[model samples]
Target: MEKLRIVFMGTPDFAVGILDTIYQNNYEIVGVITAPDKPAGRGQKVSTSAVKEYAVSKNLHLLQPTNLKSEDFLAELKSLNANLHVVVAFRMLPEVVWKMPKLGTFNLHASLLPEYRGAAPINWAIINGETKTGVTTFFIDDKIDTGAMIMSKELFIGDEESAGELHDRLMHLGSDAVVETLQLIETGKASTTIQAENDEIKTAYKLNKENCKIDWSQSGKMIFDQIRGLSPYPAAWTFIKDGENEWNVKIYAASFEAKEHDELVGKISTTKKEIFIATKDGILKIVSLQFPGKKRMLAHELLNGISFSENTIAL
Candidate 1:
């Protein structure tokens, strides 16, 4: 069979893995569509998208368009005459573009369809305390992540795994799945399954700073999941009164102490080794944290200098 002409669209590290897999397998990638470069960081230096960096290294034809529907970019996309367009970790494509390909456009979503079907699926799945999360590839439609499924694969989430750990696992799995899907498509053996809409839908919208505040009123298990879900990035935070000035601290790693606390919820119970905060059901022993203007450090290290008074409470 003739090699299928593929156009890849993606912007982040998650997408790079699948792109590399396609190249390794000798698939014909006619063009790559990625986000345009923008100024980033304190220095405001211009930075390219992750997909752009990889495309540059591989000498792939790339298009970085700010406007997807612009006539020139649309013409460029049509000029490629690609058989399939694969989208992973990329922006939403309009019908004019996604419908242009002969084999149609498909997206690789981080979570199974009809669940966790928004921007940050991996983080939200861990945050919501899901026992299992998987990846899916589906045909692109008008709604976000609501398309019919082409392929689905399940992955187990360990009890003690963090979001970052799960991300790495899924990234590797997703790469292989995409390549397999491509091979099946080329051989006219690809099978598609329609997604069912049920009441069990859980959205994984983008995380915001305001949503990272720890709610002490929640149960210890809920709070624990929330902390781990946001750990290492957009961390779960709480405020404490520091000499009449409120200080915000982000908690990265914590475990439930399974202790009975006589203190009220949101009260701090600390020792030289750990810092436990009373929750609705139990206590949360914070192991790692980051305070304002300071790097992330262990709870014991922070307690060494940032002392908590006998009557202090974590708001």
Candidate 2:
């Protein structure tokens, strides 16, 4: 078996955990590849990726390439002489980059192989009302996430779990998977199998503004899941019209009452300490929410300062 000289490639905060786990386990991480720093937020100050910040802190050899296909970048990558490549939460790789390493490139996915394969797996799993999801480590192939599977670890979803919560759990779960996958690869025992084909597979399409809008027409349970699935980030939102003065409101946390109701689906009723929106099957009780230009807070706190008139309706 070849001695492990690994090249790590990833960008978001989720990738940091997996990268750190490998570093802590005494792996020879010869190089780290992350995204280039760019301006962000209202202030527009330059911001580095989470992985870049961590890599700098550890003084690891780092490279932020604007183009993975460039000859210069490829030349630098080749000089690293890495035998193994580990990817997580990163962009799709060009064949030249992924195929360079001796033992081949493998990725840690947030969902099981051939399922929930896309940009936002954790959010879609919860948004689709799935009760279970897991992490998978697989060797890289030409296709995205259709690689031969090495190993997977499953986890049950809580009834009220948000994507943020599930993301953290999966990150830790990925740590264990990384160690096992490395052991298998280095020991020459990593027997990968082709992914199972299923016609009923679900995809995690990327989240955008159009899809993030909350549809009151959906059942209360579905709306509840939608809110939780996208919570603590790009939240589900609706137009709150209070006596003709309308504004967008983002719902972060909520509870639902699944029952037969005659009220209009988008009708909004409010109390001094509560806000309820009627849905297809029942009422959706808002727990945490954010109004335009304000931070997210408890529902009751919002109701305290902003009272909706009788014309209250969530559009």
Candidate 3:
């Protein structure tokens, strides 16, 4: 059978792996669609999307449309004569675009469908304390993540794993799943299962500043999960108050001790080499953290530069 003609759409580093795999396997990629260049960072210099960078390096036919529904963009996309469209970490598509290709468009989502179906699947899965999460390749429809599932690959989430760690694992797994789905489609052996609608579905909404704030009133385990879920980026944050001075701190790593504690929630207990905060039912031993305007460091190292007063508490 002739190789499938594919048009790839994505914007981040996660999508680069899948695009590379497809190219390395000698599949025909007719075009690559990615986000437009935008000013970013301290200097406000223009930065390109990861997909665009890779596409340029390979000299693939590229499209960076400001509007997906524009006639010019649609005309260019239609001219590609692509049999299938593969999306990884791209934005939602209009029906006209997704329905244009002969084989339809499929997206590589970070979680198993019908559950944790939203923008931040990997982070939300760990935040919700799930022990297992996986990647899924599904047909894209009008609604987000509400489409027929073509293939899925599951992986175990480590007890101490952060979202960043799981993201790297899923990135590779998702690439393999995308390649397998394409081959299955090319062979006329692809099958899909309808996603059932039910109340048991857990939605993975986008993370925001309010949601990332740590609530000391929760159990130690819950707080620990929150810290790990957002670790290394948009970390779980809390306000530390000492007398009249207050500062915001982000917790990157922590351990939970479920033993009963008499101290009030949010109270801080510190030693020369350790920092512990009281939770509703136990204690949270902070291992890694970052203070406002300071680089991330171990709790002991942070303690070396700053001292917590007897009345210090996390608000």
Candidate 4:
């Protein structure tokens, strides 16, 4: 069979793996569509998307368009004469672009379709204490993540795994699934299932400061899951209050122990080497944290530099 003329679209590190897999397998990637470079970081230097960097190294035909529907960009995309367009961690495409290709466009979503179908699937899944989550490849439609599914792969979530860890695993799993889906399309064996509508569907909306705050009024396990789910990026945060001095702190790691206690929720218990906070059901032991203007460190190391009195509370 003739190699499929694929146009790959993506931006982040997660998308790079799938692009590499397709290229390494000798698939014909006619073009790559990625986000334009933007100024970033303390130095304000221009930064390229991970997909752009990989495309550059491989000498692939690349297009970085700020406006997806602009006539000039649309013409350039049309000139490629791609058979199919594969979107991973990329922005939403206008119909003029996604529907231009002969075989149509498809997206590789981080979570199983009809559930957790939003921007931050991996993080929200862990935050909601889901024990299993998976990736799905679905045909692109007018709505977001509400498309016909071509394929899916499931995986178990480790009991203590953080969001960052689960992200890496899904990145590779998504790469393999993309390859398999493409192969099926090449052989004219591809099939799709329409996603069913359900009111009980869980949505993975974007996370923000309001949602990332730790709520001490919740159970120890619930709070622990929240901390782990957002760890290492947009982490779960709380205010540490000592007398009149209050500072915002991001908690990166913690463990929970269900012990019946009369301590008020949000109360803090501290020692020379450990710090525990009372929650609705039990106590949560902070393992690592980052204070404002400070790097992340172990709880013991942070304890050495700061002292918490019995009256201390995490507000």
Model 2 scores what on Cα lDDT?
A: 0.93
Q: In candidate 1, which residue pairs clash?
A: none
Superposition error at 185 for model 3 (Å): 0.4
Task: Write down the lDDT of every candidate, Cα atoms only.
Answer: 0.87, 0.93, 0.93, 0.92
Encode model 4's per-residue lDDT on 1-315: one tens digit a residue.
546899999998889988999999999999999999999998999999999999999999999999998999988888899989999988888888889887889999999888999889999999999999999999999888998999999999998999999999999899899999999988888999999998999999899999999887887888999999998788999998888889899999999989999998898898889989998888899999999989999999998898988888998
lDDT of 2 by residue, 1-315 (tens): 768999999999999999999999999999999999999999999999999999999999999999999999999999999999999999999999889998999999999768899999999999999999999999998988999999999999999999999999999999999999999999999998899888988889999987889988888899999999998879999998877588998999999988897887788888889989999889999999999999899989987788877768998
Please give, for residues 1-315, the per-residue lDDT of candidate 3 as tens digits.
546999999998889988999999899999999999999988999999999999999999999999999999999999999989999999999999999998889999999888899888999999989999999999999999999999999999999999999999999898889989998999988899999999999999999999999988777888999999998778999999999989999999999988886887899989999999999888899999999889999999999999989899999
- Per-prediction TM-score, please? 0.95, 0.98, 0.97, 0.97
RMSD of 4: 1.1
Clashes of 3: 0
Q: Which portions of model 3 miss their true places by more than 4 Å? A: none
> lDDT of model 1 at residue 175?
87
Worst 10-residue lDDT window for candidate 2 reads 303-312
How far residue 53's Cα lies from its native spot in candidate 1, in Å, is 1.5
After superposition, candidate 1 runs with Cα above 4 Å error: none
Looking at model 3, the pairs that clash are none
Candidate 1 lands at a TM-score of 0.95
Q: Give the TM-score of candidate 4.
A: 0.97
